[model samples]
Target: AALAQGRQPLLLERTAGLGGRARSLFARDVDSMIDNGQHVLAASYHETRRLLRRLGQENAIHFQQPLSIHFRFNQRRNFPFRAWRLPAPLHFLLPLLFGAPLSRSDRRYLFRWGRRFRQTVPEQLKPLTVRQWLDEAGQSPLLEQLLWEPLTLATLNTPLRQASAFLLYQVLQKAFLSSAATSGLGLATRLLGEIFARPAEQFIRQQG
Candidate 1:
């Protein structure tokens, strides 16, 4: 839609036939079959969903409904949070009531943080890492290690110890809302090359 609506720039950066990231090349006698990883897309990707639907390929893509979150440092230990897409305004509160990974106290602070942000000017709010927020809120290191640390690292792709506490708090706050909105989403599993590259090239050649 962005391309159709002139909201995105159109340009081909490379000149050549595009290729898929073939994962395995199995030579079976006279024929060779390649297997690739199953690609997954986030249900919340409105643009990709819209484009696929427009191309009549929505069926090829799958939606994992009642989105659930899974966390693991290892396979033996994992925490799961399940959620349902709420109708509307009520959706915002469900994460608090259910499908939340945070401890009851941490969850309360997450809400309080948002309410505080709403009431204060952005410039005045103290900036710190998620760890800082946890500490300031009186969350123990043990809780921080199991909870905020993983969440911060998972969301920011940065070590919790290194991340800015203030920024992390805001990021955590944002993720919390988005998760609530979508019944708690984690990712779109599709590889960049498979989901976007070929189709994009095809679209470009057709339109160019």
Candidate 2:
């Protein structure tokens, strides 16, 4: 809003209230919202800073000083079997080096997988699940358990069995093949911001 412009953009909120989902109670002593589960803000998550900054609460939001990721497995879900790197390879390689989850053969599978994925995509939307491709490429169950699950769910929000292998492959290429970090820049931070806001806060407040 401080940005100087020839024409001021019209801003509106659909809801009667101003705060949207993260609202506040009438009194300063009250709390507004509580998210059910834990979430993270990556160092690379740019505008998150801007929003938090705008609210004069940037310091309040805990930015992962040294960003990290976690891998959880079925039923036990005890703790993340391990952590991963937010940017990608640097995070992945540490574990591979220490053999936290991936073994020597698993590492080879990852290398081969990256090389192969580097080569296809929206240009070639093949009909194979990532699991299928990995298995065919000789990846084992252990490899799938350790390396693939976190990515399948977290990155794409779908299971390997049902999700598009091509889509996941594209994500890998964008994250690993191109840049040092998948999240360096140019990625959309909030789909809602990009897609809405004539009355965005209104919709959020009243959202089901």
Candidate 3:
């Protein structure tokens, strides 16, 4: 960003490696490269995707067309959630309303929160945690167990009782409500170091 703005940015790294915790290590025991964690990406990350394209590493990450997720509840039962290729909100809304494993009454709770999500400001949600917000919104226990709870953990890496409602709202808005394409999941096809860190460092040094 600094370079794009005609500014020379000085990078200060405390460790020898770039990408911080998003780096990869060669595991001789496993005989393969392994990332520190499963660093998943959302297609909503437009700027990051653009950067990958600029670096000619666009193929390093693979994205789904539209959005789809399969939740395995048990050994036999599996729930598939797929968003249509429609516009923003409708893509996910159709699946949530008709296909989700929720009772009709429980699905109705979406209307209230849907309105609130559109109307409420960040300041109004700042004091509440995700659990509190869901409770106040009359979200059923089943809905929380199946959808919101898992989503909160995956996106924020925090428990629903501790995660900020405002943050959760922001993530949902950007990743799901913005556009159908944005809701898709993206996974790196290569090692983190090769896909991002090394290429990024090389690009930066060459520019400097």
Candidate achieving higher TM-score, 1 or 3:
3
Candidate 3 lDDT, 84-140, residue by residue in tens: 988767787778878887887877777556666777777889999999998888888
Compute each candidate's TM-score over C-alphas. 0.51, 0.49, 0.84
Question: CA shift at 103, candidate 3, in angstroms?
Answer: 2.3
- Runs with alpha carbons beyond 4 Å of true place in candidate 2: 1-67, 72-91, 180-208
Candidate 2 residue lDDT tens string, 60-152: 444342334455566765233332544455454544546455567777766665556545545445778876766666867876776677667
Best first by TM-score, ranked: 3, 1, 2
Per-residue accuracy of model 1 over 1-208 as CA lDDT, tens digit each: 5567755564544433243432333447747533343333445556766877665456655565555556565667666655546653234445544554556776676566546644544343356555555565676564565566766665555676567666554554444445545434334344344445556667766664
How would the candidate models be sorted by lDDT, starting from the highest?
3, 1, 2
* lDDT preference between candidates 1 and 2, better one: 1
**Lowest summed lDDT window (length 10), candidate 3:** 109-118
Give the C-alpha lDDT of model 2: 0.50
User: Candidate 3's error at 111, in angstroms?
Assistant: 3.3
State the TM-score for model 3. Answer: 0.84
**TM-score computed on alpha carbons, candidate 2:** 0.49
* Candidate 2 vs candidate 3, lDDT winner: 3
Candidate 1 local distance difference test against the native: 0.53
